[model samples]
Target chain A: MTRYLRDIFFALAALTIFVAASPVQAQSNSGPLRIEITEGVIEPLPFAIPEFIAGSSRVEDAASDITRVIAADLAGTGLFREIPRSAHISPITSFDSPVQYSDWQAINAQALITGSVSMEGGQLVVRFRLFDVFSQEPLGSGLQFVGDPDSWRRMAHNVADQVYERITGEGGYFDSRVTFVAEEGPKNARLKRIAIMDYDGANVQFLTDSRSLVLAPRFSPDGQSILYTSYETGFPQIYLMDLGTVRARVLDSQDGFMSFAPRFSPNGRSVVYSLETGGNTDIYLMDIASGRRTRLTDSPSIETAPSFSPDGSQIVFESDRSGSQQLYIMSASGGEARRISRNAGRYGTPVWSPRGDLIAFTNQQGGRFHIGVMRTDGGEERLLTSSFLDEGPTWAPNGRVIMFTRETAGADGAPAIYSVDISGRNLQRVSTPGMASDPSWSPLLQ
Target chain B: MKLFSKLIGVVALLALTACGGGGYFGDSPISGAPGGEAAGSADPNSVAYFNQTIGDRVLFVVDEHTLTSQARATLDDQADWLLRNMEFNILVEGHADEQGTREYNLALGARRAASVQTYLISRGITSGRIRTVSYGKERPIEICSAESCYSQNRRAVSVISAGPGA
Candidate 1:
């Protein structure tokens, strides 16, 4: 299995180079038109994914399930529309067989994904290949992933990621996870728990019971730990929990001081959060290992929601020092700060995108709350979502999408997680059993 | 009618106790209860009376934290009540409307609560007897989106406790 993986990786690298060297074909000339997905309205590229051919009867069900998941992952992005199986001119049956490219092309399936699943030593080995139906060539070399049967969904996501990367020329966030607050009960006395799930909102596992309120569960850079603020101790305090062991410990728990809104630094060696001392709130950074504390801002005005840039050289945060809440960027080590948001509204929760190109934030103006994005210099501000209350924007690993909490108004109001492309398209409500909020997207799985 | 009013008061007390902290509407009387000053502020010396009559909370404009004249007047009454009841300590919970970011609202809530604390201190209240926490936009008295509801939701409520420490 290990040898098979090595050979597949080499073949993929070689195929990628070959594709890069070839001249791109136009849709009029036909073969496969290399989708140049830049900006503007996107008509989803139509694709066909047949059921994986099972190598043995034992893996038959796993084969079909994996294929469905892979198709769903691609279709959910709104970038690719899956051609219905009913429209297929041919069905894929054998693991090793010649493809009928003409048949797929006749059905207008520009891309075809085929795979096989087999059981080896009580583990599942899934190999897949993507073909440009019109180009009459494999878009990327065939590859396989080996994992336990329970992780079949992850393996399927891996395949989808490869296809997405090949077609879009960008990394895929399909295999990531989201940590959010699951809410229940009434608005006045809502019960909230820390819950983590697959990026598509599956396999939900509650990390904490709803005994106490938990807010803002942020994944570490490595996706192995979570930083959140909890009122379990009867006051707001920052807690770090390892996802594997579920053991949590409070950080910088100084007596009489309230700490919340904690975010991990880019390197995961330190955390920046808001600490309230004697009725004054300011941003503080603390080393995870050394417990060294550095006060980032000493202003009498409130300073919080500190987010580190991808390079860790600077931090963007929300402050009211300008007489109203707004975004400000300052050196990570703490010094002179410059205001970033110059709009006529209160901007807060400024999160630097993983790509470090844009900053997503919550903006309140015109008697409405909006989740918006702006360039690093606070220019080109674009509001992606507006509603009764939309806030707390978290970026996908690739920074192409953002997930936030949108709550309806009135006595029955409740929050649910929603995601949208950076261009303000493909708005989707993430599936959750109950009301959910404060979604923090994890980096892609290793 | 007197017996009915007393029964209503008992039920209101029970509801408040069952709520653990407080209801979303604060001390607003429940449905079917008499809708006058007598129904809400029956206990003159109690916290319920303070909340419903003497004003346990102060409202703020959209994002502003500066105290209004009405807020100052309320704080003056709260200071006098705190002085008279020396056995009690207070926790001021600052809250914001649901129109802001979670963390930002928290900071705004803290600012609002601190504004109240500062006013009370200026009115001769001891600093050590008071503690402040910001709920941000998490808890709202009015969950609607209009300005009327937002104005009510952006408030800081003083919760009195038994001890001198918060």
Candidate 2:
């Protein structure tokens, strides 16, 4: 069974396709066709997707599901708005038929996506084409994907990803996964278990039981293993668990020290985390394979929540050295650091964006908490959401969105996962099983 | 009527007695009804006694790990008691109020627990006999948004168990 799964994973890893719609990887050079995404008000561009054409009766459900997922992916970005079918004048019936550009234009659909679903020898085949309706041209060549029927959502995401990239010039995060701590019971006795799910909170699979308290499950750079803090042995120590076998081994089990807040380097070769010894908490880096350790900060103050830059050259972390929790950037190797956050409130949980431009963090001031983002130099600081508690910001694969944990106040207060665009728009709650906190986004999957 | 029933429930629960230290205290142990095998506060070495009389925890201000005068007083008594009871190994669990980020709170809690450990070691308690862990803001003894609850929530508890020191 293991060998069979490894073989299938390899096929999916290659994203193998049996049908090649065309070998064209060129995009038409239309004038300023790409949406230059920035941190500001964006009018969600209008798009339309008709029901996918089904090649056979056995694949009707697959066709409709794929179309819906593709539409959902584009709409969830807050960058594109879907045009309902009721507003459409023409329904796409054949995959090869020419698009009724006039009909789509009548409804103000700037972009149109057309797809078809078919099955051959128990393999699901999906193909799609994106057209700039106003330009009356196919943005790029049509692409096809072939995979197991169980991976239908992934195929839909692939199609939507291509459409988004063709229109926005930005990478798509629809095909990624997120790992978080699923919670149960009350606030005081809340039981936590590590769970992994699709980006939209589907396919929830619990990695660990609620027996031991687990917090902050982060994905490795390769997304094949997870690093989190667990109380399995009555101490909060970081543990690495392989997703293949669902087995875990303690990464640091020092006899008297505690370890937590672990993050992977961009290359996935080493891990950086916080270690507490003699009551002094400082950041430490460990070579995962050799178990060798390096102390990055010898501060008498708190320094934790370390995140590596995209190039693995530097790390951004939180510290209270100057007397309050704030953000700082230092070299990946231990060295002098400079403070980055220059505001009235305390800043924490600094996460470097994948695009190497912005850092997201949690801000607290005037008795309220907020999820905010700033430039790499801590300039252009902007608060995204304000509530009782909004923290632990994780960046999406495209670096356009952020997901964090927002908690309520009072006796019956609870924590829920929420997300927003980096522009401080479209704040939406992400549904999970029961209460959840500490969300971490995975890199775009292969 | 809802508040009345809750008050009555609290009073009734405080009236029960047990030697174990799970749910046996509420402000003060009013259950010392001169009963059998209770190991009440009158018994110097019992956990029930340690929790009720000697005070097994120390509270802290928000974001501050420095021990207060009252906290130091409690640890002084705790160290004295722990020295007399050598078979009793204690696990120091540090906690925080739900006002900070999880990672920061965990680091803060570790500092708070380390403060308690330092005081106990100064009071001549062996480091091996005292183990420390931080729950961050995950567990709380009080559940409200006010300082009345936050003061109690931000605490370091020394839970005693009868075993050889690690």
Candidate 3:
């Protein structure tokens, strides 16, 4: 028999009063190592995002809309609350002058984001800088990006990226693109195809013509290729496409079997996929160069959704060999599989983090779907986001954020992509105009 | 989530062409039954009960299954006809827009079908006679990238089976 402790809550209440008057709370220290009362008391930084000053040119108003999108992208994370432009005491019309920090501080803004737009060599060039109001210094030098004026919105996202990184010490997700399946039509006769869009949903481009169903479009580590399963051949076959060149080729494998659920290895040298033969699905690895195939799992039960660890030494996949779908980690060369998820629900879509510390997976328990993560050792499982349906989590390059598709039921049932930090701090919807699914995050393209 | 898996499993089954012997569906007269039938008649030559208007579709709110006024109107006609015939049962296949997750769409689709089932039940149709399944967004009818296709895709289709009454 185990003993139960019922006095813990009461005991903690008495201890709180003693710690309140501790000497550590009396004096304030400014160094990085000082323990301050910032925990739980710290509030989100507030800043004003004035409409970007557009350059006088032949084009329409581009900078204002671009900056607005950037501001929305940054503020959507819930980390930075945007102060209304009405509260700004200083008008930041130019990017050349050093910011007056006192003016911002009076308005309670701890940070300021300023940028300029101009036409250089017939191309749009955007220069942007971010400042820390308290330190009264620029966090870093300003950055300039060149692209078509049509891509001004994307350039704005890049500017937001620079500011986000400087403040959070983490890489930004705004600069990447997500490739997913765009859907239309009835459930039984749904038409789907490959599509790509800017991280903020500005430029939605259909990559493949709608001929067959597509599932799980994963970007290569290098951001150059997409590996996905297409039903176009009348059977699920893994096709690898060079998205930059619009060149497509099927990853060569044996015929008479279906191959689905493809993801590139971390190093981008090999492809891990599920091959179905004789009614059984198993994980298989294919050499991208020689087209050689290696079976990783030999089981009668369904075993799909194979992902590689960052080091490419181990593979994490979902299998029902244990009577329920659970995450399993095995040597990349295929031996000694061990289960990682001990939760009550079946888990699938185990994506290893780029940092090699955790594996993000989809969990189904208590009739709800959740996106959760666990250490590589299968310890410390933490569910990040819970929803009606939140599956297919892909990792940000820094491994601090997880982005997945969240589709809600409605008269015109719609789906949207969403991202949450691993600490479950920032939960924001990544909006796309059309229905979006199977969102695989790309590594930092910068 | 369950419905999403079922939809995906059906899709995978379709991908593999590997479903066990179309059992229970192959021999049924509704298997190859063309659209139409005599009201409450059992004749094999009679068109299957519950005439489905071609290209008729229903709309859903964003990520929800509850029928809109338009969807209710569409289902109302079908429900009235099904009530008159008394022999028809329907399989409501729920679907979702492309913007959502697959499994949630499946659940959303199921919820949509259940919503229709509730509507039909409120309209005096037997709950036992109506079965609900969601294909999620796995199957879409429209292939284009416009609202024209999206509106058509988000629907609860009524597939009438040749049961006792019809």
lDDT of 1 by residue, B1-166 (tens): 5665565567556654452233332223331234323644776666566666787789898777889999999888889888877766677878898776787777778789889988898888888877777778776766566778889889888876555321
Q: Alpha carbon lDDT of residue A300, candidate 1?
A: 91
Docking class of 1: acceptable
Score each candidate by Cα lDDT: 0.81, 0.83, 0.67
Q: CA RMSD for every model?
A: 6.0, 4.6, 16.1
Q: Which stretches of candidate 2 lie over 4 Å from their true place?
A: A1-33, A39-41, B1-39
Comparing 2 and 3 on DockQ, the stronger one:
2
Candidate 1 wrongly placed segments (more than 4 Å): A1-33, B1-49, B164-166
TM-score versus the correct structure, for each prediction:
0.87, 0.91, 0.69
lDDT of 2 by residue, A164-189 (tens): 88888788998888899998777655
lDDT (0-100) at residue A378 of candidate 1? 89
Chain A TM-score from candidate 3: 0.86
Is candidate 1 or 3 superior in DockQ? 1
* Evaluation by TM-score, superior candidate among 1 and 3: 1
Deviation of model 2 at A143, angstroms: 0.8
- Residue range A1-446, candidate 1, lDDT tens digits: 33322211221111112222233343232344355545743899999998999999999899989999999998988888999999998888875577899999999999999989998888788888778887787776677788767777778888999888888877899988899999997775578899988889887888899776689999999988999998776567899998877779999778657799999999999999999886688999999999899999999988999999999999999988888888999999999999999987889889999999999999988778888999999899999998878888999999989999999887788999999988898899999989999999999887
Q: Rank by TM-score, highest first.
A: 2, 1, 3
lDDT of 1 at A71: 96
